[model samples]
Target: MWTINDFPAYGSLSGWSTKGYLACPNCNIDASSQSLRSKIGYMGARRYLPENHNWHRSKLFNGEIENRSKPVELSGEQILQQINLGTIDGKNKDTDKARLDLEDMQIRKELHLIRHANGSFQKPPALYTLSPAEQIGFYDFLQSVKYPDGYAANVSNCVTAKGGKLVGLKSHDCHLCSKTLRVTDLEKLQEQIILILCKLEKIFPPAFFDVMVHLAIHLPYEARLGGPVQYRWMYPIERMLSLLKGFVGNKARPEGSIAEAYISKECTSMNQLQNENSPKATDEMWSLANGPNALTNTCLGCICNGVQFHTIDRDNRRKCQNSGLVVKGDHEDQLIKFYGYLCKVWELTYLFGHRVVLFQCEWYNTGSSRTLRVEPHVTTVDIRSRWYKDDSFVFPSQVQHVFNVPDTKLRPNWRVVEKFQHRRIWDVPELDMPEFDEVLQDDENSTIVPTEPIDDVVVLRRDDIVPQIISMEVSQSNKRVQPEGVMDDAFICDDDDELTISGDDEEDEMENDFDTDTDLEF
Candidate 1:
């Protein structure tokens, strides 16, 4: 399974057409489109915005006030209606018909062609088109971006800068990004997502949505329906297919070739896998997985909280840095973060086959204001400043990974400390231990029923929405550029700025929707 934006696969799987004005599978029937002078454009994104946004009143967007609430696309029964109405053909709609529709609506008047007395129309230069210099600069910016080591696995090869334009610019991390933004919270993700899409609509041209951008609206719903993304993502399945395809030595009979190779590999590994992982030998498997605690289980690398941490000695010859660390400690009875460079590691044996991983580190001075400073954005630590006198060790469970970036050429001793989090890694929750003492008593779940109703639970709404405003400096001579931060007053549109929706009611709904085993408020 892959993203719904993959039109053909999506259409075949869902049995809905991804064509014409209603290309978005989610917004099947109600998806709006505008006829540009050249091609059709998805231009009704303002409908997703809050009813009273300042953007609605501005002439910048379609030259009309957006008075519609967010469209809720329910199902795909509309596809049948479209077919019966003779509108499901795969060709793009007539631009002249679209122009007539726009003319009748009396919106986006600037897109109208200049008509002469001789019954001839003259085309005007599109305001959306970027100049050569601006296009080059944009391409350069993308090409010059420095992504993390593994975060952009195929993005580099996918993007290309040539002839003052970008080639093959497609969604490399749409699914990854969708999961990251909405997976954090599913219930309220819909509102935030609508805002984000509306923000994009404000920045990008109508044509920018040709890539089925509206499909993003349904990601939260899909995530709620499907428990985990791994079950639907194409990475594992595609990789397996690639491996099987690579086994094809005989092109004429590829099926047989793949089958032979698969059988041989499965034969070699299946016995070992089944023998080692048998459920009847659970104790033996656990003993092997964790290893014995009697003699020692010294290690060069340790996996704690999904992050694979290596000892300083193991990384002596490697270029990757994993020795930098941060741990919480008590300083003047205040919980403060302590930054350090890992020196050594120890696996201490304990009773009942238990072991503890300890990190011996050389810490930087965090007590003094000058030695370490937390800026508005990042934390800067002076490496020369010493804290080895205070503390030397931290438990693996308490340690968090941190990377030191050289602050500047001027301050050679100072370093900017950025915390490292395992992005793609997921830690599986430990299985519940069986109660051998008696029939397991189902104790009261605090999360299912809290001791007290949370009165101050934060309810996300359009009134409190804060969107990140970005400034795009385009080099154009005659074009009148729109001012940046146009959306700075998005929902603060009118005199009645007070929220119409009750915060308490919204909070109660959110709290009830949120189910957990612990008494944690999200």
Candidate 2:
């Protein structure tokens, strides 16, 4: 029987009371009479004062030593104009206007500003505007302000604890409901509220103790009946109403328009679900150039051109079917050319369809060893091209790291040799190379290892090499594949060979790499 409409609104109790006092709902402080009035007057008066007036000083007029300043009273019309109380003609001086004028005069006298010799009153200053940082600093200062008996800290802690409980509930932590809404916490909250109200009575007005203030005391009971406050809160419902309001194209018949829009949306959604052939409903199939026997379905040997090759296992160890040779003698001569010597090779299928062979090559560097290190860098190459199998000795000039390597080599005429070296030949002792398969598995797991302290070279996977290409694509596609539901026999199976890599340890290794650059050989 109890509906939300039955309860008083949050701000219904706010505004100036019949006694001519303005109070805050949360602090229950009278803005017109007490410390709040002084603070407001002080801040407001500072805007109109000249820069040399020493605004930071506690008392501008040295009130303790000097005689008490005479209070300057203004007329009803002046008071109304000063407070923006609307235009009231001189002919109508009603009892209400007189009462308001008297109240305004009393507030002005309490503020205590100096009256000029000419008898003209100092105008109330504009509101103080603060930047984001200054606003935060001001809020912190207000929160830190102590109550008479040092109850401010206790009140602040209680409010903060209550807020944390509300946040937990909003995040769907239902288990915390019992602990947060315990009878002890509720009693403590009530006591704190009472103490705060008492302390603030001298400063705040009756309007400050609004319905919300009383609601805090009954929160525990409300939680008992409704569960979490978030579930019962109007914010989510209000947000949904705002969204529904956007669908109202016909203002004359808003309800009808909203209903029709809702129905159309539902119908469209239902059609999308039922229609499997719809482009939006289905995922794009991978477009392969070389039929089903593409590199994605088969091994790297399919495009090897009769050249023997090996696969890099999960542990990064080379598993050789024959001799672990990537290319034979003549075939190696055809693939290797002016770009560099192919030091290491890897076959990878990126995303859905992208399949290519990544060649790690060491380019000929003419510069002094100190100027630059001719490190083996990885780059993608199209397997379908005839240049990959032909004996033309024409290299793909679009190399990844060749442009980065300085061409300070003193001897340019030195012939670049072509040879079939094992994968270990390209492995640097100091560099802990990132696994390609693992990097693709989870982007968050990937760590950037700086090659050296001085050099800004970050050694990541080949897929993570090119900043323009890989950075966006890899991050968007890389998702951790959760294992499917375990079968009855899965529990009995052993996973001893599975490499358990921690993200923290990987980051630590990368950080350590930066410090141990001295041991690294060029």
Candidate 3:
């Protein structure tokens, strides 16, 4: 459907006006949204989930079980004829407004806002809010992230460049980039998507949802009918249009401008390379071109197989530890993979523009299972120990990129090896792929395949036998001590810094004085 575009463009293409809350094209007139004090929120994500799903029965989401059925699709004309209301009542959901709503409702008093003696109001951070320590850990994790060259956009830019505050990430950017492209199940995928969306509602706030988010409900169906999003998206046509638009110097005559630009760019260019059929240069001609000096360049970093790697010389400056590498080759009798740390990068320039790049590494012994252990689940190696000093260098093509995690702070010598496939590959899951016994032979005795009996899979959040209990104790200091006379709708803060619901003792005293005919001076 050529679907890739901005939110407004998405609505326009679907023949729907996206100005208001009823902007979800897939939901049609049945789209739901709660109008807040300033913005609209979509909190009814649980309605889309299957009724039998565990999330439907959980009270964690807004303290209620969702009984509402899936949204019913209706036409715009039918909706207008059915309701015809200029405005819908807004709901005070989450934050300070939520506390006020609960206060008025005389329920969930434990969640009421805490008023300090200094007249400042502060609500305890919600479950979704990360703790200060956890936030620091999250930032550290992102800061230390590394990816192969062309594997992904610079993730560090989203963290380190944001002045220590975590910000939203455009993972695939606003252009062409696919993170995951493989999908297997054609039947249960739609059902799975609904459950996932329902879970998101329990975690994120209502304001997170918009028309575009609701549009995801319809994607699986579209994909099933039309095909993958990669092929059907607008990139191809958009690129063509962009190229033509770049050529246009005159807006008044776009066709002629595009033609001129195409001719100038494609047919004739001063810097165009010579045709392959042109006569080859002699050795003397090559020497003249070289001018008696060899073209040589040195760099601290190098890119191989779309993965970025840095030499040990540059490792001190970088947060991403990209010096680790694993190379698999023949030993005395068997094939063994050696884990190592890259020490240097050598770029050797040769005659006629030929070049060679070698990675110098400090290898660790993989002669026995003590230095390297490959189990069914995890692969661990001791890269702290060094071996194979004589044959320490490897070509870029011979190495596989790997990141290591220490087994524990105390066991720094033992590292859990995490391997990455070649960049821009399929990344298919084993379970999803069809079984072919003849094509692929299973080796039960392999180090990767453990002979130990597998344990039963455990299901999460399935508390069938015991019911969980939650208790909250509101501090006496934060509690409102005085009686608030005749509570009204107004939650106004006066000059004295009080969130007054109604008139206080000072107002009553002033009224009494006025009734007694006492003269008042300013």
Candidate 4:
């Protein structure tokens, strides 16, 4: 329902006067009078209309008077393009090139000045000149040139540090350190703006104190909306409109064409929902797992009955037998040894095939003084498990068992063990545990286990529990260690700390061209 009038050009709406002497939006410094002036002179000192009235001028100068005209008005884009690539007036080729070259050099210097003034980083060449929206977004002219206690620099630092982190509330807690820091930073920013305004009145021109500049003071309040500026910007609507423009195939009847295209797309989408043969629904269910344990088509392990197991090769079963593998134990820091082959089980469902693996390992109980030989058992384990030392053993390391090898239903169900390493504790001194205590109520009908007396510590045999350390051979050298107080005499020199200077002969020659003894005075 918006019209051209509702969305007026920002420049026109701001009552921006392209001609005549205009004060800077920030410092109220006349643009034409600035040390580094604009190529297109738009701002400078001038007499008031009443002071230069026709009657006053005629009376003072006897009819002879100075004449003035409105300055040429240029669009923001035109001004920026001239600043970046220099004036592109259609004129003599050689003169234009030389002028452009000089203007380009001056523009580069001006860019550096603006960058330092705003405390922003060096902009890329592509962004040397500001776009219309970018000019409004930056609003650089509204910022104070200086502030008390280097307030401008502090505000820049605070904004740079906290801006990116304030985009979402999902990861932030209201009472946490991050949230508190943002609040304090915002307060400091507001204080700096107020301080700057108080001082700006004394330094800048009257035009600098305009309402447009004052509007900048409320930016912090706007940012407190709990997300980045882009979230509330018009970019999404603009993008959607651009997309709709592409949908217009008929130029004469563009609106009708766009509507038809949009409705047709929606109808097609609705029709696709009822079509079971469509690939979209099936594709949604085939998504792969993410993170360190992401699943792949060539995955070596699978889960069955709430337990994970690894696939093994039947041909290499003999090679994997007695292979030393590190398996997690019941205790937090405990690791156990499991020696055997890994095997898999296949099952046929109504729609898809399923595969699971089993670890056929010999359990070596290390809790006793002697290496107690526990009965061998087959159980489901994580497929990621492998031999820690040598993998070349007698039994098959991995095997793929086919289900239709006649009757997987007749086979015994794989045993699932409890995973002790799943629960992790990450407590530290500064990051203390939560304040609240968890309440655990016992069920009246549930049976409780009886407490048992502690047993004596068992001294394990050296061969049974020897620490596994992989040792590397070291080469012997004749180099001797130096005494603590001794210094290397070879590196000592009289000019060790002195800096060396290199003379530029060309620069000296250029400087000699200018006569320093000249009596010229300003």
Residue-level lDDT tens digits of model 3 in 1-522: 236665567655555555455555555555665443334445666787767866677665555677877777666676565345521110112445444434433434444566666655656444444544555666765555654333444455555332345333442432333322223343355666665566665444444454445666766665555444454466556757976887888999999998888877865544343332333466446644555335545556677654667766565554356677889977898788888878877666544543567788898877787778887677888765677899988988889887765554335578777775433322223365544332222222222222232222212122222221213433322222121221233122211221112122121111111111111100
TM-score of each: 0.53, 0.23, 0.53, 0.22
lDDT of 2: 0.29
Please identify model 1 stretches exceeding 4 Å from their true place.
1-8, 37-40, 67-69, 76-87, 90-170, 174-184, 197-203, 238-300, 310-324, 341-356, 362-365, 371-386, 389-392, 402-522
Best by lDDT: 3
Whole-model lDDT values for every prediction: 0.51, 0.29, 0.53, 0.29
**Candidate 2 residue pairs in backbone clash:** 29-204, 30-203, 30-204, 30-205, 366-408, 366-409, 367-408, 367-409
Candidate 4, residue 197: CA error in Å? 13
The full ranking of all candidates by lDDT, starting with the best, is 3, 1, 4, 2
**Clashing residue pairs in candidate 1, if any?**
none
Q: What's the best-to-worst order under TM-score? A: 3, 1, 2, 4
TM-score of candidate 1 to 2 decimals: 0.53
TM-score of 3: 0.53
lDDT tens readout by residue for model 4, 329-439: 443366554433333322212121222223444333344423222333323333223333332322222322211011122222221221121101111113355322211
* lDDT (Cα, 0-100) at 176 in candidate 1: 37
Error of 4 at 392 (Å): 25
Residue 36: error of model 1 in Å? Answer: 3.6
lDDT of each residue in 151-192, candidate 1, tens digit only:
333232323433332223344433332213233355466666
Clashing pairs for model 3 are: 148-307, 149-306, 149-307, 149-308
Task: Tell me the spans in candidate 3 whose CA falls farther than 4 Å from its real position.
Answer: 54-58, 71-112, 115-120, 160-164, 171-180, 185-193, 203-205, 208-325, 330-385, 393-522
